[model samples]
Target: MVRENPTASLASLASGQSFALTGGTVILEDGSQSASDIIVGADGRVVAVEPFLDTSSCGACVDIAGMLVTPGFLDAHQHLDKTGVLRFTPNPSGTLQGAREAFAKYARTAGPDDIHKRATRTVERCLSRGTTAIRSHINVDKDAGFHGIETLAGVRDAEKDRITLQLVAFMTPHPGQDFDWLGKNIDGAVALADAVGGTPAVSEDPPRYLDILFSAAVKAGKPVDLHLDEHLNAGVHLLDAALDRVERFDMRGRTVFSHISVLSALPRRDFQRIAQRMLDLDVGAVTLPAANLYLQGRDYEMLPPRGLTRVAELHRMGVTIATASDNIQDPFVPTGSGDMLEIARWTLLAGHLRGDELSAAHHMITTAPARLMGLGKDYGLKAGARADFVVTDCIDTDTLVAGGPDRAFVFSKGRLVSQTATETIREKEDA
Candidate 1:
């Protein structure tokens, strides 16, 4: 039985100081929850995770009985540059093309200060909800003209102490501009960002667009994250083309495909074939259910299909898959709170995952995305890993992933960065 300790206080630990959190249920890498004590070293790395630890030498010891401790959530795919613009730019049609046009108009006049302020607010909201790291795709095109990349890089540096922000120079296509413009600007944007990304499906020539993106990533020694085949037209899909480029550029284990919703329209055999190729190439996939479900299947009047990729099938095929909040309160999504657990829940329902697979859903927001972001062994709740964790009142992984807890404590490198608790009031009625 788990014990309840409502009076337990979470003390902040500075850098170069050791701390211990005891009597908590920790979610391990293998999707199991165990009662353990997490010992954070003086260097802000986990020294040990055992059933009990010697806290005599630690500077602070906190008892967190009946709480669930897990690695901080990782949002592998997001659009920080386009977030929080619902008031100014609303997608009246609620379609993908409408959103693109809306955001393009907004970007034409948006300054660096506007982009920085909006992105910084989103980062704070994400951190308060237990997201320690985010991989945001900022638009890099003729309309935006590198403003998003320059502004977000500053935000990444400013928020380095509280959150880890990875920027992807999203090479977007615009009218009246040819591939030459993208080619000339991609290298410079990739130099300033952590990865190279683009929306190949929206380009006039998908193959050529993908080639430019892959070449830039290869030249810069960076990973490629692409918005691949987001529509439901399987006949006009580009997954195979992207896979061919993945092999041609030798980007194995360094390429991620986001929002390949076309997979939902393919037959089982065809999807299996593509899945096998992805596994062989060590390519990763991310499903943006929030944006896809809202933006796709709008033309169909009845029995509209869920616009997510084949998440359960991909997992069965042993493909490294993750889910993320693609857009937040913007024209693309128009609804999001920067909460990763909410994203996990959407994946659980829209991805057709069973109730028993809640642990797998939890991994979509944690370990799966971490691996896609190339965090490999540096993340998680293991010894020698960075001491980034989220403590919640939920007792197990299922409870945590279902809807999340009302109270949460976020720690980055063993330092308490954000904490939230919701209070409820009820009226008593006379019987």
Candidate 2:
């Protein structure tokens, strides 16, 4: 059962036990931190964050010798239905084209039972790795039809207590086919949602398709996310149209662009102008590094595309950029363990973001994604904040990312929901 007031109840749980995190450095925003003791109250909110623990009035105290404590994770973008399809079919062709083909086959063969089983396993792994929330896009096309919506909604409701799942109804149209029918169906889906989705860049006439989709989104008064320019083709300019419409519709901060891989190949001047426009429009960007790197570079033979978007530049320009796994162990890119830490590791290496930037990359998995999910005051660890956190074996943000925690202690609204441990022992055999 879902608690009426999760945060308050978590605070009440914390008030009962005075946990002392000794010898561990706490990570904070703005690139600085100090040794801190966090006291959670019975009401499920963090009651106090101090330099030392004064446990005079507490009933129980956990001595975290030198482990790490950090905010729970939030995965920005994923496909719950597709993620579960990976167990059987692995992408052999290894390009977006091939993956799309494989997805078509898998969607036809896969059933709701299969999708749910895989998704539940994947979500369990995410919780084990400290992720508390996810934004999964459910395909609502003619193939699976309403099955995608119903199945994902079921997954959302089932996992709601453990992990917050936001649903994005994605509309995909076949090439050279009329999207009128698909468009009507998309409108119907949007009517049932808090937001809508589009892939105008993938359409035959991107400018026209963009107009149709965003206009639909505006009419629905829902937020929008577009899969724009996902390939590194120099000729692709659909992102410009998408952004232009956002400006035209005054949907600043309500519009988002995901997977604009072409920007990585654009000239510095051109990229700068686009970045500025995104900042002006308050539009966010989501990059799926694993999927991009895996599915991209297919058409090109040698010196293939990097497959990553202009992430660093966007951040430098104050654009909100988040990272996503996109597909986990599916027909596309085929090998994901459903852990956001793995996503961040590859992202940091591929995106060339380091040091403090590493921490920023961490945010792409945590608070940044939360911000995009409309989880406003419910995102962090503080007084009046939801008591959602993970205890790990690291001292600060850097260590949390670098040293994959050996164990994760998870709590949602003060109730222990999950715990994980990975044990390994290596020693010299015959010295």
Q: Indicate which candidate wins on lDDT.
A: 1
Query: What is candidate 2's lDDT per residue for 77-158, written digit by digit as tens?
Result: 8888787566566567787777776786777777788778878888888776677888877777766676666777887887
lDDT score for residue 190 of model 2: 67
Superposed by TM-score, candidate 2 places the C-alpha of residue 119 at a distance from the truth, in angstroms, of 1.7
Please, what is the whole-model Cα lDDT of each candidate in the order they appear? 0.90, 0.73
TM per candidate comes to: 0.96, 0.87
lDDT of 1 by residue, 1-431 (tens): 11244323673445567888888899998888899999998887888999978878888778888888999999999999999999999889999999999999999999999999999999999998999999999999988998999999999998887788999999998665588888788899999999999888778888888889999999999999999999999788989999999999999999999999999999889999999999999999999999999999999999998999999999878999999999999999989999999999999899999999898999999999999998877789999888889999897999999878988889888888888888899899999
lDDT comparing candidate 2 with the true structure: 0.73
Name the weakest run of 10 consecutive residues (lDDT summed) in model 1: 1-10
Model 2 TM-score, all chains together: 0.87
